[model samples]
Target: MPLSEHEQRMLDQIEQALYAEDPKFANTVRQTNPAVHYKRSIVQASVGFVVGISLLMGGMILQQVIVGVIGFIVMLACLLWGLNAWRRVAVGGEAAAQSQTKGAEPKQRRRQQRPGMMNRFEERWRRRQEGDDR
Candidate 1:
């Protein structure tokens, strides 16, 4: 939904305040979000690696060794890029998930919640059986 006139004015005022107070921060926020860009770079590099490998294989099949070598270089670059991004994401993902689940961990540790989690699977199964019976 579009903002009402009052909300629009408030938003405009906020934007003005942000720019006036810290134009650099406003511009930085407007540019790119690093996490989003990192994720995208990882995806792009992965796809590029696969495509490059395929091209390399195709060139080899045509007996174009030089072209295949060039393709290998491009694929290696992609692999390095993807690997770096994946490492960053893996480390960050672990920390992020741990933070989100911090409180839940105490409950899990106290109750041996792995079994309870499994009971949830059983509950789902029971519901499915009931659904099937109906």
Candidate 2:
């Protein structure tokens, strides 16, 4: 449901107050993007993976079992980390695309566009708010 006029006004007032109290913090929060963070993580993980490869090779050449084991562990960890970040980016990109497409639809159509689980949860919430126990 859309916010009531009073609620909207109050929210606007709160936002203005926050900006006035600390414009720098507010700006930083507003400009921060999760995708950028994910991309950076991916780059870091890739570099770590390369380092692991070198360590593994060096350990092999030096005839050190411990170093080779440690390098293998590092490579495995970095591979998992990079894969996780990539997965998050893909999921987030899908959500962003869905939201953008949703904005183009009519309001009535938008209401019908909610996923089944979300619709059920909203319905239950509405029932509880209206004093219906079942």
Which number leads on TM-score? 2
lDDT of 2 by residue, 1-134 (tens): 57999999999999899999999998998899898999999999999999999889989999999999899989999999999999878768667777867876786676787657778999999999999978
Off by over 4 Å in 1: 1-18, 21-33, 93-134
What ranges in model 2 sit over 4 Å off? 1-14, 93-134
Residue pairs in collision within model 2:
none
Which candidate tops lDDT?
2
Model 2, C-alpha of 60: deviation from truth (Å): 0.5
Q: What digit string (tens of lDDT, one per residue) describes model 1 on residues 31-103?
A: 8656676799899998999888987998889999987988899899999999888776765755676676776
Per-residue lDDT of 59 in model 2: 95
Estimate the overall C-alpha local distance difference test score of candidate 1.
0.84
